[model samples]
Target: MEKSVAPDNNNLAHSYNHIGGVYMNIREYSKALSSHEKALKFYEKNLPPNHPDLTTCYNNIGSVFYSMGQYSKARSSYEKALEILETANPSNHNDLATCYNNIGAMYYHTGNYSEALLFYEKALKMIEKFLPPNHNNLAHSYNNIGGVYMNMREYSKALLFHEKALNIYENTLPANHPDLATCYNNIGSMCYSMGEYSKALSFCEKALEIREKTLPPNHPSSASPVVPQNTNKNNTYLLAASWTIAVTVAALVFMPKFRELNCTSAYEGGMKAVIWTDVLQALVMLVGLLSAIIQGLIVLGGFGPTFSIASKGGRIQFDNISIDPRVRHTVWSLLIGSTFNGLSIYGFNQTQIQRYMCVRTTRGAAQALFINAVGSAFIILSSCLIGIIIYAYYADCDPYTAKFISAIDQIFPYFVMEVFSNIPGLPGVFLACIFSGSLSTISSGLNSLAAVIIEDVYKGLMRGQLSDERQGFISKIFSIILGAVVMLLTYVVSHLEPILNAATSLFGALQGPIMGVFFLGFFFPRANHRGCLVGFVSGVALPLWMLVGSQITKNQRKSERLPLFTTNCALPINETITFSSPVRSDPLLDLYSVSYLWYSPIAVSTVLLVGLIVSYLTRPLKPHAVDPKLIIPIDDVFCCYLPKSVRHWLRCGVDHENYLNERVCTEFIE
Candidate 1:
C-alpha cells in the first residue's frame, strides 16, 4: 500500500521530516526525535550518505537534541550534517552557512567561546559572499559572532559586530521590531562592560523604548529583575537629570541655528511663508489621520460594518443631553463648556492674536478664522471617526484589558503599530504628522510668549529700549527660557493620566481669565481697571483651585470610560484575570467630580459676574469718558437688524455713533 501510494523513499522521508518539525515546534522533543530518526532511517536506506536529504535529516535531529539540552548529541549531529554538506558541495552555500551558525550556537551554549568564534566567522564570511549586504541572515551571523565576543570579554570586538548587526536591522527592519531591541541590548551590554556608562544607558534606553512599544506592559522582558552590582542607583538618577539639563542647554545653543536654517525663512518672509507652512502641516495631519481611518475601515470591511460594530458595542452615542456636571461627555457640557473654551483659545489667546495682527484688515482675519473653523471641524470629525474605528477593531480583544499597554492614551499608538506595522513607512508618516503638529504649536507658543514678554513687559512696563539686533538677541534668549520652562511643565504633566483632559483643564484655568479681561475691555465700557483686576484674579483662582483639587481627588472618583472586554484575550489556560471594582467616594467629593469641560465656562461666567458687580460698586467708567476706540462696537457689528432702542441697550453704554464718527475721522486723517 505504501509503495503504491508513493514509490519514492525521499518523499516518504520528507513526510517524516515535516512531522518532526511539527513536533519540534510544539516542544515534544521525544516525539520529534523519533520522527526525525525514522526519516534518517529511510534516507540512509535509499539516499547516498552525503545526500542533501541525509544532511537535512541530521540537522532536524540535531535541532531536536538541542531542544532537549543534550549538547553533545546535538553537536555530533550538527557535525555530521556539516560534513555531508562539505562533501556534497565544497563551494560556499547558504545551507553551509546555516549549518555553521547552528554549530556555533551549540559551541557558544557549551561555553566554548573560541570554537564558537571560529564557526561564527566562517558563517559570517559565507553569508557575506552569498547574501546582500543588508540581508537579515547576515545580521544574524554578525549577532552570533558578537555574542561569542561578548562572552569572551572582548568588548571592542563585540561592540563592532553588534553595531554592524544593528545597522542592518535599522535599515531593514520595522522601527519597533524585537530583533532591533535585541541588537540594542547586546550593544548596550558591550558598552557597559567597557565602562562607557552613558553610551550604555543610551542604548539601554533605546532597547527599553522599543520593548515598551512592542511588548505587553506585563511582559517579563519589560521588568528589571536585576541591576549590575557595580552600578550606583543614585548615579542613574543623577545621570538622567544631567542628561536632561545637557539636552536643554544644547537645545538652547543649537535651536537658534536650527530655527534659522529651517524656520527663519517663514518668519522673515512674513505671513505668506507662515501660512504656507501651516497649510502644509495641516495637510500632513489630515493625510495621516485619513490614512489611519481608511486603513481601519478597510480592516473592518467598510464604514457600514465599522459603525455597526461600534454601535453594537455601545461606542456610538450622541444624545447625551444630561445636565449632570459629573457626566464626562454630556451634550450640555460639550456645547456650553466648549464654547467658552473655544472663545478663550481662538478669540483671545496670544498665539492666535498674533496671527490676527499679521492680517492687513479685520475682514482678512475674519476670513482666516472661518477657514480655521472649517479645518478644525473636519479634523475633529476625523478624530471621532478614528476613535470609533479603533473601538470596533478592538471590540473583542481590548489591548488595555489584555495589558498590551499601560495607559489608555497608548491605545492609538498601539493600534497604529498593530495595524500598520506590515506596511513600511506608514508608521513613520504618522509619527511625522504628530511631530509636525507639536512643533508648530510649540514654535507658535514660544514666539508669541517671547513677543508678549518683550513688548508688554520689557518695553511697556520696564520702559526698556534696545537696538534691533539687541532686541532680537533678547527675544531668542526669552524663547529659549520659555522653551525650558515648557519642557519642565511637560515633565510634570506627563505623570497625569488622560493628559488631554489635564492639558485642556490647565489651559482653561489660565486662559479663561485672560479671555474675560479681553471681553471686559472690548465690550463693557463701564468695566473699570479695578473691576478687571479683581475679576481676573477671581476667575483664575476658582478654575485653578477646582482643577488642582480634582487632580488630588482623582483616585477617589470612578473613571468614566467605555466598556472593555478581555473575553477573547490570548491568555494562558492557567492564567486568571481579575478586574477590581470602581472606587467609591463620599458625596462631599462630588465637587471635584465636575466635568473638566465646565471649567472654562465656570471661569468666564465668574469673571463676567464679578467684573460687572465690581464695576457698578467701585465707580464705573462713564460712557462719554470711555474712548470709542477702546471698546468694540458690538451693536454696530451685529445689531443692524434690531431697532435703535434695542441696539442702544445691547451696546453696554458704548456709543456706536461716536465710534462710527471717530472711525470716519481717523480714516480721513490717515
Candidate 2:
C-alpha cells in the first residue's frame, strides 16, 4: 500500500499564518490580515475549504478585526473560523484549541469578558492534554483569564493568572531573558499596584535591567501591542522612547547643571546634586542592565535601606519536616517540590531558556542558576532590611496612605514620586530604574512570546519547517506587538487598586490548576487526553471558585467592620479580627503562609490523581499521546543525569517519585 502523503501546503500556510498571528499580536492588523489571506489562499489551493488551517486564517483575521475594535467583524470572523474548524478538526483535534482560543481573545477584546472566558475554558480543555506543563501557550490562556479578573476588579485573580504565566517563565526561561523580564515586570507591577513599592521596585528594576541587556538599542518592548514585532517597528519610535528616557534622565540629572547654567532654588540645588549623583547611578546601572541579558545573570544590591522597620504580621520561620502536606516549608516539601519548581522555572521559561540556549554547556546553565539563587537570597535579605526601614518610618503609622501613590507596594514608585515631588533630580534616577524594569520585561516577553507562538504552537502542530530568515522575520514582527500590549496594560494598571493582594492571589490560584495539569501529564504516562481535559478543567474551575469564595469571604469580613455612622451601610472592616502572633526569633519574620507554600504540591497531587482517574475513565487521546518513557519505570542509568539533590532519592528506592522522562528533557531543550 502506498503511504498517504501529508499535504505540503499545510506547512507553508501554517508558517505564514503563525507568523501573521505574531504581527497581529503587535496590533499590526493589516500585516496580519495579509498573512492570513495568503495562508487562506494556500489552504484553498492545497486543501479543502473546510480544512482546519483555513479556520486559522479566518480566526486570525477576526482576531485582527477585534484588535482593531471592530466587534461585529471580529465575531463574524470567529464564527466563520469555528464553522470551518468544527467541520475539519472537530472536538478532538488540537487545532480546535487555537480556534477556541482565538474566539476567547476576541470576546475579551470586544468587552464580552464573560464570553471570552467561556471560550478560553474550551480551548484550555483541549490543550491540557497535548502541551507540556510548562508550555508558554498554556500560560497565555492563564494570562487571559487573569486579565479578565483584572478587568473585573478581581485584582487577586488577575495577579494569579499573570503569575501562573510568570511561574512557568521562571521555571522555563532564564532570569535575564526578555520573557523572564516580563514575568518579573508583571509580578513587580502587581506588587507596585498592591502598595509594595519596595518589592515592586526591586522586581521592576530587575526586569528593566534585563531588557537593557537583551534587546537591540532601539527595540520597543516595554509595552504589549498585539501585533508588535520583537524588534522596533520604526527607528523613529525606538529613537523617540530612548531620547525621551534620556532627556528625562538628563533633565532630572541637570537640575544642578541648570543651576550651573545658574538655575535657582533650594530645590534646584537639591535637584542638581541629585541629578548628577543619579546620572552616576544610571551609568553604573547600565553595566548591570546591559550585562544581564547577555550573561543570564544579574546582581542588584538593595535600594539602600533607611532605619525604618515595618512590622510584618504573617511570617514563617524554620520548622520540622512534618508529614502534613499543609505544613509551611517542611524539609521535604521545600527540598523536593522546590526542585521540580526550580527545574520548570529554568528549563521551560523563555527568559531562562533563551539565556542558556546560547551557552556552550549545561554546566554553564547550572552555574547561572546557582548565581540566580544566590542573587535571589541577597534580594530577599535586602528586602527584609528595607521592610525594617519601612517599619521604622511608619511605626507611628499614618492613616491617610493613598492606594495609588503611597501604599507599601508603592515604595519604589513612591520613592520616585517623591524625587519629583520634593527633591528634583532624584526622579531622574528612579525613572531610569522604572524604564529599566518595564522595558526589559516588555522586550523579553515580546521576544519569548513570539518564539513560542511561532515555534511550539505553529511548528509543533504544522507539518512544514521555516527558514531561519523567515523565523527571524516572524519573531521580529511579534516582538513589537507584544511590547505594545504591555505598554497599554501599564496605562491600564493605574486603574487597579489593591494590586499586591490581587496579583499574589491571582498567581497562586493559577499555579494550582496549571501545575496540576502538567504534573499529571509528566508524571503519569497512562493519562489520556480525556483525563487531561477533565483534570485541567477541574484544576482551573476549582482554583477559580476557591479564589472567588476567598474574595467573598474577605468582603464579608470587611462588611462586618462598618463604622458607627452609616445610614445605608456598605461592607465594614472587621476591627475585631486578629491574625496570628508575631515571630520575633530573627525579629524579621515575613513569608508566604503555609497554605500557599503547599498549594503547588497539593494542586499537582489533585490534578495527577484526578487526571489519572479521569484518563482511566475518559480515554480521550490515543496511547501515542502518552510517551511510553514517562509511564514506564526507570533505571539506574538515569541517575547520572539527575541533579545532585534528587540523586539520592532515586538510590534510596524512591525512583517512583515523579520520574523524569528522558525524552521530555530533550523536547524542551534546543
Candidate 3:
C-alpha cells in the first residue's frame, strides 16, 4: 500500500527514519544502521543527490556507525553528509560546521590526526565566519582541533587550542558546567603529557571539582584516572609536625635571649617590644589577605561580577535578623552577644590589661584602645571579605561538597593553594603570615599569664616584694611551663571540628566568669569576695555544661547546607543514574542548640544574677567600708550630666570624693 502511494515515496523514507531513531535510542545499533540505510535508499531514489534530507539520512547512518565503533564506516557516512550539505546548502554555515565537526571526530577516532586537523580547521573557519568569537560552537570546533593536536603529540599547540576553548567556556558557561569540566580535563591531559605535573594536578583537580558537582556519585568519570588523587596526606602531616617541632625547639632555645630583649619588667619595655613585633606580623597578615582578595577578584573578572554571582547564589546575606537563639548568625547575636564577648576580652583579659598598663597615661591608654579597636575591625572585615571572595570563586562548585577537602575549615588553605600555587613564594609567604600571627598571640598570652602569676598570685599570697632579677627568672620559668602545656593542648584543639567555634566557645565559657568577677569588684561595692566566688563558679559551670552538651548533640541538630547541584554533569551512556533521597531531620528543641554567640551573654547574665542574689542573702559588704579606689566611679564618668546629688545617690554610698579630688589634683600637677 505504501509503494502504491508513490514509488520511492518520501513518506516511506520518513517512516524508516522514525524507526531508525527509535532503534538508535534503544542501542540496537545494527537495527538502527539497517533502518537508516533503508531511509537513505528511499531518499536517494526520491530526491536529488544534493538534497538536505539526504544529508540528514547520511548523518544518522554515520552516528549509528560511530556508536558501533565502525570508524571506517562512520568516516564514509560523515564524508557523504559533508558532501551533500556543501552542495545543497553552502550558505548554511552552522550546518556546514556541524558536518565538518562530525567528519573530523570520525577521522580523529580512526587515528588520522592530519585528516582530523584538516576537517576541524574547516569547521572552525566556518564557525568563526558566522558565530561570535565566544560562541559555544566555536569552542566545540576549537576543542576538536585541540584533541587532534594532542593525539599528534604537538603538546604546545594542543594547549593553545585547548586554552582558547577554555577561555570561551569560562566566559560564557556556568562555573560548574560539564563542558567546562571536559575542557579542563583536556588541558590537564595536555599539561600531564608535557610533564608539567603541578599544572596538570591543578587542572585535574578543577576538572574533578566540576565533575563532582554535576555528575552522579557513581559515574565512571568520578573514578576516572584523569583526575589526580591526593596520595601525600601522610607526608603532609609529617612535614607539618616536623615544622611545628622545629619552630617550638627554636622558640624554647631562644627564650632567655627573647626575654632579655623583650621582657625587662613586664610593663613598658616588654609591652613595647611585643607591640612592635605585633605591628610587623599584622602587616604581613594584611599583605597575605589582600593578595588573596585581589587575585580572587581578578579571576572572577571583578568585584562587580563576584558580588553579583554570590548574591544570586544567596551567599551575600546579612539581613538574617531573626532572634532565634539557635540560629548561627543573627543581628541580635552579632550586636548583643559580640558586645559581651568583646567586653570580656578587652576589659578583663590579662593580655589586653598588660598592654593598657604599658601606656604612659590614661589618655594614652584610651588612644591605644581606640587604635586597637580600629585595627581589630579592619582585620575582621578583611577576613570576612576573603571568605566572600572564596565563596564567589567556588559558588558553583563547592570544594567541600566535591570531596576535595574533608572539612569546611580547610577551604581557606585549599583556596590559597589553588589560587596562589602558580605564584612563586606567595603560598609560602601566606603560610608564614599565618604562623606569625599565631606566634604573636601565643607570646602575648604567655607573657601576660606569667606576669599575672607573679604579681597577682605569688606576691599577693606571700605579702612580699621580689627583686627585678628574681621576678624575671620566675617569669621565664613560668613561660616555659606554660608553653609546654599550650603545646600539649594544641594537639587536642587541632582535632576539633571548626576550631574557631570551639575556641570561641571555650573562651566564653572560661573567660566570661572571670570577666564577671572583675565587673563585680569594680562596679558592685556590695558584692563580697564570697558572692563573687559563688557567681564565678556558677557562671563557669552553666556555660561549660551547655558547651559540652552542645558538642555531644551537635550531630543531631545539623544545620541545612546551602543548595548544591549536579544538573550539568554528563550522564554515562547506557547507565542508570539514581539520585539518593534527601535525608530528613527533626531536631529536638533544647538549650544546647543555642548559638555559640550567646554563650558569653549567658555566662555574664548568670554571674550578675547569681552574685547579686548571693550578696544580698549572705550579708553583703557595707558600701561605706569599700575602698573608693577599688570602684570604677562610673557615676562620675558616665552620669556626669546629672547633678552631684543624683550622681552621689547612684554611687551606692561609696565615698569617691577623696578619689575624685586626688585625681583632679594629680591632673592639675601634670
Winning candidate number (TM-score):
3
Name model 1 segments beyond 4 Å from true: 1-277, 460-464, 572-588, 633-643, 646-653, 661-670
Q: What's the lDDT for all of these models?
A: 0.76, 0.54, 0.77
Report the lDDT tens digits of candidate 1 across residue range 91-135.
748988877776666566546779778987888888898889999
Off by over 4 Å in 2: 1-245, 248-344, 399-408, 415-426, 460-463, 487-498, 548-553, 558-599, 619-670
lDDT of 3 by residue, 286-358 (tens): 8888888887887777889888867865677789999889887788998988898899889888898888888
Q: What's the lDDT of the predicted structure labeled candidate 2?
A: 0.54
Query: Against the correct fold, how does model 1 do in TM-score?
Result: 0.60
RMSD of candidate 1 to the truth, in angstroms, is 19.6
TM-score of each: 0.60, 0.42, 0.61
Better of 2 and 3 by lDDT: 3
Per-model tally of clashing residue pairs: 0, 90, 0
User: Tell me, what's the RMSD of every candidate?
Assistant: 19.6, 29.4, 17.6
Candidate 3, poorest ten consecutive residues by summed lDDT = 572-581
| lDDT per residue (tens digit) for residues 47-81 in model 2 | 77777666767767766765454545566777787
